[model samples]
Target: MQTVEHESFGSPTEIREFPHGHAEILNVGDATIGRLVLEPGWRWSNDVKPIAGTESCLAPHFQYHVQGRLGIRMDDGEEFIAGPGDVTSLPEGHDAWVVGDEQVIVVDWFGATDWAKEPAGNVAAHA
Candidate 1:
């Protein structure tokens, strides 16, 4: 049996920030979760790519859109939009951006533990 635990994103265990976006991470048992707050005009490639050093987002995400809207484009060119109340499982190698003027908030059940980690040799950038 396992002991029950309670956690809050309000005082996250970890926080990573980048241009126009940020992720607040929490841990429960063996799983890690993140609450991402992406501002309007935030884009994975444009904001996070410099730190990630990847052509596209390589973090596989299983997420719930909590508020506002977001757009995703896969490396292969497939594109879609996600709004509040939507659940999405995005594979690696994709780009995501906030849609319209709304700030997008999402809860990621996967990929948060390693997302937005500072790139090699980039000291104290974000994490």
Candidate 2:
């Protein structure tokens, strides 16, 4: 059995701000996952690949909208809106945001880029 906590994984002050919040990484089998706490203005956007299209894409993401809201859009012309208590599976192209100046926190789950690699640990805990 393995155990990890938010306190164990502090906010990355070098890259992001503090009190805006931090993350707790949980490793279970081959999954590399963590809970991301987004402050009222948290945002992340990356250049992407559309898997099967000539159009260069935005990354695909799946996030649980635990609190506040999130707005997502594509450069071409598609939009996805979300709010507290909402869970969404992001498609292959988009940008995301926190809604109305309210903080948006989510428990994010991601798998290793290579399926063969295993995560550091596999346990659950409260933050």
Candidate 3:
């Protein structure tokens, strides 16, 4: 790695879009970071599941909430809401959704590499 390196979401290395949401990803040295923007009415089960081909979200996440509110429900039914200025660690096997009219934005430090990605041979039609 360089002595110092910098990256910006403004110029992401990759972009993945799904229903009602998108992820802008940056590859910094050996780390991958993602900025996720989930529009109002976005839900993991409804939006991402088709792309992921999973019953629930398989990517664990460690994220910092940047704006709006996000509601999360675990496979065991534990539920909570996270808003701006909040940091959340979520394990696999959970679903999340936007909680209000505002868009939900978060910077994810983990799980971005495979988040919302379509499974092999199942490429989604949306561009």
Candidate 4:
């Protein structure tokens, strides 16, 4: 067993950033944890879809909302808002965005590997 501590979202193995959002990825043991910060006016379609090359976000997520508010809209037209202290398990084929003026923070234990990743063969496209 081992222990790793940080004052905040520090010492990340990888960090993916877009125009209005960013994900700090930390590798611990066999898990990849992602700390996502979505600024106000950030929307998955407008911010991340081009990188992913998908109509909706294809990365499924199991995360904990840390602060602010986030809105989610599924492909089937289902929609909801997730706020602070909420635990969410979002499947693939969804769009998400920040709902308020505050930045939305989330810690995801799943789907961090490909979140915000530029599609294969399109490395310089989103850069």
| Candidate 2: worst-modelled 10 consecutive residues by lDDT | 111-120
Tell me the alpha-carbon RMSD of every candidate.
2.9, 9.5, 3.2, 3.3
lDDT tens digits, residue span 27-81, model 2: 5555555556667655543211112122322334466767888787776678878
* Whole-model lDDT values for every prediction: 0.89, 0.49, 0.89, 0.86
Off by over 4 Å in 4: 1-8, 122-127
Candidates' TM-scores?
A: 0.92, 0.55, 0.92, 0.88
The superposed Cα distance between candidate 2 and the true structure at residue 10, in angstroms, equals 9.6
For model 2, the local distance difference test gives 0.49
Backbone clashes, candidate 3 = 0
What is the Å distance of residue 97 in model 3 from its true position?
0.4
What is the per-residue lDDT of model 3 for residues 15-113, given as tens digits with 9 covering 90 to 100? 998889899999998899999999999999999888877788888899999999999999999999999999999988899999989999999999898
TM-score of 2: 0.55
lDDT of 1 at 73: 95
Which tens-of-lDDT digit does each residue in 1-127 have in candidate 4?
A: 7776553467688889998989998877777889999999999999988787778887889999999999999999999999999999988889999997999999998988778877677442221
Q: Give the clashing residue pairs of candidate 3, or none.
A: none
Candidate 1 per-residue lDDT, tens place, 7-126, comes to 999899999888998999999999999999999989988888887777888888999999999999999999999999999998888999999999999999998877887765743222
Deviation from native of the Cα of residue 94 in model 3, angstroms = 0.2
